[model samples]
Target chain A: MCTTCGCGDGDTRIEGQGAEGWHRHADGTLHHHAQPGAHAHGATDPRRLRIEQDLLAANDAHAARNRARFAHDGIFALNLVSSPGSGKTTLLCRTIQALRGLLPVSVIEGDQQTRRDAERIRAAGAGALQVNTGKGCHLDAHMVSHAIAQLDPAPGSLLLIENVGNLVCPAAFDLGEAHKVVVLSITEGEDKPLKYPDMFAAADVMVLNKIDLAPHLSFDEAACIGYARRVNPQIRVLRTSATTGAGIDAWVDWLAAGARAAARSATQRAGPRGVVA
Target chain B: MHELSLAQSVIEIIENAAARDAFARVRKVWLEVGLLSCVEPDAMRASFEAVSRDTRAEGAVLELVAVPGRGRCPSCGTLSALAAREDACPSCGGYGLRPVAGTGLRVRELEVE
Candidate 1:
């Protein structure tokens, strides 16, 4: 049995389906037979049962471990995903500044190069860890695990992982967060969520940032919210402008509530067994 | 672009499959890209060629089957073959359209030697 998810079978042909592969038996009960002229060709057959699982499977396992670790440590983690220049770092800085006194906040900023986002977060008076993905486009579970170790926030703390500026790959890899929040600037089209449903579907919250520039731009807040709802009905939408501190309080309150909810769940899980008197 | 990473993932899956199947060379790859997947197929193909160089899948033809976005329209039932801008239901013109399919990105099959 596979230990990680306990769903692994020996069958390599059908991933998560059955376990049929080369087998050896002492009593000759069962064994897979080699195909005819197996050694004639150097390459494997293309029609062989596809036992190969997703390449991100390992990263997913690590993400699960990170999730359990965060729960055990009473840490509330949020995975923030968005496109480039969507103001994730700017919104994060403003949020950190606003929520610094309410609760202990930490950030894990991801980028292709430079610690500019981390520097911005630090300037806002919050603990920040920069994760440079180098050539990679997204932040995986292992990277977040390492960054968490570096942040080392106190129990009942909030940690935000700002994923690399990409909407697609980051959505495929979960970073062990209580919630996945997506930031969209007003400059981006209102139909963005419609165009990128998977990312919006994966997100638990959607922040429409840069509302201050709404008048200067052609962005429609209602249409954006409508499209976001169309992609994910359960998504909580928040409009904000870091430049003017607009809607900062509501976003901060939402973060605090999220942290409290996560901490409460962790405490309940650690308290006692289900059978109570 | 993120499509590069996705193409790399497809290569990994195919390579691992080849190793198990004992195939040395892959002739072609067929992939199903859903409209809602947000992956640009052109970019993905470019990335596949660039990253698969020198690998078992080098020079392999990447055939993409583009699947139209599927959606569940609140005004109607399941809808398919939707136009890029029109996500509304055909019967009732309701705007509540939840995607039902066309969000998958996977290597469906491989022709190997």
Candidate 2:
């Protein structure tokens, strides 16, 4: 159970899935073989199960399902991750406003408490759902799947999942997103990338948020980008300011491209077998 | 920390394996922790103790196998041991070393009855 969200206690509820929903094992155990003589091993002797399985195989399986569902629905899902107070919500709000009428945009806001971010997103003219992960530092695939099942963003739309504001754990938990976008504010030190290299390495894009404050703050932008590239050479960096709307267009364009690609892929998958529609 | 959740996952895996293998209880668990796997053995042990309560894995001895991180230098094509992801290649002194192994966490073997 996550100490932050009280999640494993079966209290966190997703919309449309009443309380006690979302992967609650009554016994907190999954029993695959009930009978003692089910396997070939002797019933009296001890047996060694050479289970060479990854610790996160369960989570990864859920993520695969989520990814397939997203692909089939033609929805471009982006998992936004960053440290607390890195301006993730503000940027999300700005993004919602920018792409509201042109393209349907929805948000899944994650936090330890409060519907404040969801309300802010709704005020920005986009569909929003709040998932409070009480004591959980990161959002897992199961939680995201439940949230998506309830939210049901329209096909060919963009779903922005703002992960719990943490740099470490979120990197390990895949939420079935098309890409993981990491936000780094200029207010934060440039050494942030080096300090939290896992997040930087896991992310597909690194958004340098609050760039308007770059002049006022002595943040080494080059060093920050350098550090990020050292960890992830393929990561794309976008400079943006939610307050001044400096790089909103580029961000929106990137999102649009992803949504378009998703739509195209979905169409191809839905087409006749072996036919490239 | 997320180690709690990870420990819970380990227990779940063990429980499922026990059921499939028809084991009464788990006597021991052998885990492979890679150098770049981002898991601390001490934290994992503490979390396992906390989450394995009342489960078949309770009181089970956890044997941790440490796997060293290995990377191949893209520049010199030399394979060497790496302690960190950003470690430069030892043979070539190049930063572009691709990790080849020691980045996984897995339940290698289990002793059960």
Which candidate gets the maximum TM-score versus the true structure?
A: 2
lDDT of 2 at B23: 77
Which lDDT tens digits does candidate 2 get at residues A130-189?
Answer: 999997888999998999999999999999999999988888899999999999999999
Candidate 2 at residue A273, lDDT? 98
Worst-scoring 10-residue span by lDDT in model 2 chain A: A29-38
As a whole number from 0 to 100, the lDDT of residue A117 in candidate 1 is 86
Give the residue spans of candidate 2 off by over 4 A.
A1-47, B74-76
| Local accuracy by lDDT, each model | 0.75, 0.82
TM-score of candidate 2 on Cα atoms, chains taken together: 0.85
Give DockQ per model, in order: 0.11, 0.25
Give the per-residue lDDT of model 1 (tens digit) for A89-193: 888888888886789999999999999889989998999999999999999898998988888877899998999998777887888898899999889899889
